[model samples]
Target: MAPSPSSAAQHRHHSSLPTVSSAVSWLFLSLLFLYVVYYSTILFEPAPTFTTTTTTKTATDCQDISTIESNTTRVLRFDTELRHIAFGIAASSRLWRIRKEYLKLWWRRGETRGAVWLDKEVTTTENENLPDIHLSEDTSKFSYTNPNGDRSAIRISRVVSETLRLGMEDVRWFVMGDDDTIFIVENLVRILSKYDHNQFYYIGMTSESHFQNMLFSYGMAFGGGGFAISYPLAVELERMQDRCLQRYPGYYGSDDRMHACMAELNVPLTKEPGFHQNDVHGNLLGLLVAHPVTPLVSLHHLDVVDPIFPGMPRVQSIKHLLESAKYDSASIIQQSICYDKKREWSILVSYGFAIQIVRGILSPRELESPARTFLNWHKRLDYTAYAFNTRPVTRNPCQKPFVYYMSSTEYDKTREKIIGIYTLHRERYPYCKWKMESPEDIDTIVVLKKEDSSRWTKAPRKDCCRVLPATKNGTLYLWIGNCQTNEVIEL
Candidate 1:
């Protein structure tokens, strides 16, 4: 009585198909619900918020015009010297070219009265119109063959005594130098003015070469660079000349013998930064480019240094360059080099007379980084204080923007508590505003802003910046800030 087996099987298969479809639909709906819940939880979570607050601070009015006026007057007073300056030269044919180039300029200056002390008689034809000439044989009995095989020591050692005996009664400073030495007269006058002419001051700087300085007394002023003996000192030296020469008979160099005599007289060397005994031989562009803050007095051994300009004769060109710079010493000292491919430098003459090697060859990233400090120039008068106080922050700027910083040592605590900032390159930015903030106990933050961002980037930045007067043309007035004692800290 049951239906066929095939019909029963077909009915069962149709019923199973409906159950499988319903199960698949439920699984898909469950997965969709979980995905929706996960996404909704993420979307509903709190969003992070960032806030940047801009601080607006008023620029402090700190510049005092009267103080600057007084300082200028002081500088003017320091520039003049009442004493007569006399040049005593140790002459030799070996340095005839130097004599021709340097003496000619000295003659033209008319500020210096000069005389050449020679080992033998030299004619005008051979010596090139050099002023007064005296034979060394006629001067002093001190004579010895130096290990260096040069008679310069004997000539230099005796010249001082001979110059005084020759009736230089009116001469206040007897400057003894070799034929190769070139002196800046104005700078010499300014430097000598610092000391009393009546007192016996041996004003000279030590040798630039470490080896030479070590071999001889580091305290001794190398005579080739030239040294000045005050009238009073010269008188004492004259009295002890023969006696001192006999004492140091084995001494070959004039400087060592002079040192011995000075030691006996209890006259310590009064070192002046301007007098340079340049012993190194190479391109001197680095030396002259970053010249010290102090005035340049003299340059010795010119034959070794390269020419100042390209394609020009060394001696004549250097003399002309010096002559031009002599009139405007400030301009020469404050000179900043930006980009000179021919000269092989990018930015020359930084805060420490440092050279920045930024030729076209360097990448932008390399140029952006801080410059390497080249201390080819001599140590600053106060190396420790200078290094600690005037450390730089950025190297992007070539020339220093702020020339002056208020020194806690200079001003009294009761004096108007304002920091002074002076700018040398005012042509780039006429006005600048600065904000000072101290975060850490040791660090002080200074932010400088000008209307023109492009120009602001050129000015140099330092921790404790150098403070120089705005004497150059187009220089701007000083900027004063109400920075507290707590704000100024050691780096």
Candidate 2:
């Protein structure tokens, strides 16, 4: 126990040499093991797979788990380009002339891909500014028992599988819609970009009417509004959908058929409010004015709804609305509420759509709900038919909104922002009995907004706005954008 200091130091030195030697030996072994692993991988690894959307490769086929895992990483849904999607539009030869006009509105001849599945064949010329046309496979074997439903549902339901069978190269998502469906392609791409193509996602929205959702599963994605299926999901659906269809022969429409098959696969719906089924008919003002704070992806049942801009042809009005979307689809019809403290007035701007000027200041909460300007799909059903919240139109003429539909939108080079100019819709509202000041004399409302797509991927909030009121003639100027820090909307 009482050793000399020199002796104790010598013992410590002896023990440290073995410790150092053992570490060096282990380090050498680790390096050697790593070297072997690296070389073995290089020598035995299978060449990387180059898969087209049609490739039949499976993870089970490969014994090299490391390579399989590495290859699967390439299948994620990020940075998806427009070329990666394929559209399956259900059409009929009888209505081809009219429906093709709708297709021409947004169909990019070379840039967009996929075909229109028609009930019968139609000849196409090189100059046809539309997608290729294909005849749907005869669905005589399928049964539809709904007394009011058409057998065409069977044909339309098969469009997705037939489209997938076409084996489009590099297709990440398969989008399905009706002949009359108007798709905003850029917004569709943006909406799909949020999902993972490697996983199964049935993305779309249900009907605007509660009765439709009640009859059909609330979880169903109405095909008329358009729904997207991931490539993997499409492949899985293609396998069992035909057999699955047999079990649901009584389905009312194509959407329910697809929904039933999706249910069989256990893939729940991924609802995107922007994909509007628009089951209601009549003026679309109330709905578009208070659209959910999301990109305008698609609009359905446009034929039944009145022209978006009063007095203009239905087609022309839609084209007019699209002018603003062309510049900024992400913010199209997005609602922004602002107040005029001086005038004690409330103004709501639905960019690229319409501007609402109320006679008196109204709370933002009340303005957020869409006014019951549109009738329910079934006229017998009252305001309660809407699946979403709605407010009844006021019998008081003073409270009625002085609406101005967007006449045009243009980018101001000097201002560095796109400006939307809305003009008064000439239909005279019930004369106001109240003795308060009104926007009746104001002929124009000009709104300025800078476009940014990234705002959608972040938290969803209504864009903040201020009433500039710097008017020239009868014009009112306002600017809307991301809110400033601690910005509050108040009187």
Candidate 3:
């Protein structure tokens, strides 16, 4: 079986040559295939990039998916330079759902789609389910009555523009509104669609007797509550920015300024059934969308706390608002702690501050006075009660009489100061507590500072009451004199 070594070596060498050649051929084919694929992909599939092109030549027609067509109607809401976070949350969650229900019924008219729910704020998880939100970033470009007024308003305006670009860029008709606005959405949308596209459509509850008539009367001018505008009107309104800024070379409230701008442009504002303004009876504007719209637009005085209209009982809904917050224990202290009283106070103070700043009594940098800062921060109480990074301003009248807290000695001094102030302005300053219609208006309020249940106790007054000396070690008390109700045990 033995053969020559040279013969065997030659046979092995020949076999190895074919194996190497086959490997080389496979490598060449793979390189050629990859080159072809890379070129093909370059020609067919493009990389992501930005462009200035609009939707004019496209079948979808609009650059943004958010715009409505001529036959469509939208319900929009605006926010100004203020913190109505609690109200916004409440409206978006509770009232919006109500409006959606009405739209479901009213949208049946010839493909007259549902109303557009819009707001001028950065949408969050709390309101992500809400239909359309425009996150605004250029609100600072807009002016407000006071310096801080822009904080809420600018954010809102930025959001509004964003919403428009997103929803109405190619849409024909749309409605603008505030969070607290109330109306019959379905009916309004159906009615608005039956209008002339050539004409401006500004639909809301019109006032016949100017601003004096019950807020929801008939007038031609569009209401800030919820106004529907055609595509032309939307475009025209959007274009009014230059003139609007020029006309008011200073601070301006968004809603009122918008009305003023409309007037200047001579746009014929129209109306539909169920459009409303600031009527709080909750009865005047029957089930649709309700607005907490206007005050959020500009600076609010941080003094007027409490609801204006008695239509809705002042229920403590902060619990609901708080429950809606995400459970991030770390950031709990960083959130706004909104209080019912403080919320009212913020409105009053902001209103006054807005006026002052507009009238040149204050500047933006100095706008954050002790009182102003306190009120601004007070709004956070709604969602962060009993939770804090630092201790809350604890010191008398922690809940009632609307007075600041100081030590017992300081309380007396402050009380005397208040009495003296009231005495001096008694003719002009009326007592707020006695404005109630009845003696039975008293309700018990149990206020808590910490999570301890034992710390909770009944507020001392059984009737409409005011603050008093505490009877317990760490509790406060109140005495409802008009209703002759009084009990005390806690400090």
Q: Tens digit of lDDT per residue, candidate 1, span 1-491?
A: 89799999999999899899999999999999999999998999889885533333232111110112212211222222423777788777655644656666555333457688877655566545466777765434655645664445655787888888888647788898888777766557656766677889898988655556767877898887889998889999999877887777667687888889999999999987668787655455445544544666788877666554434586665555554443233223332333333323333333212223332334322333322232223432322322112223334433322221111111224643222122221134222222221111111111111111111012322112222343443322222222234543121
Whole-model lDDT, candidate 3? Answer: 0.31
| Model number with the top TM-score | 2
lDDT of each: 0.53, 0.85, 0.31
Which tens-of-lDDT digit does each residue in 359-404 have in candidate 2? 7888999998999899998965497798999998877778778898
Candidate 3 structure quality by residue, lDDT tens digits, 380-449: 4332221112122322222122221111111134332211000010112223443223211212221211
Q: How accurate is candidate 2 locally (lDDT)?
A: 0.85
Where is model 1 more than 4 Å wrong at Cα?
Answer: 1-72, 75-83, 125-129, 138-152, 334-346, 350-491
True-vs-predicted CA distance for residue 367, candidate 1, Å = 13
Error of 3 at 171 (Å): 2.2
RMSD of each: 25.5, 11.2, 25.1
Alpha-carbon TM-score of each model against the true structure: 0.56, 0.83, 0.33
> By the lDDT metric, which is better: model 1 or model 2?
2
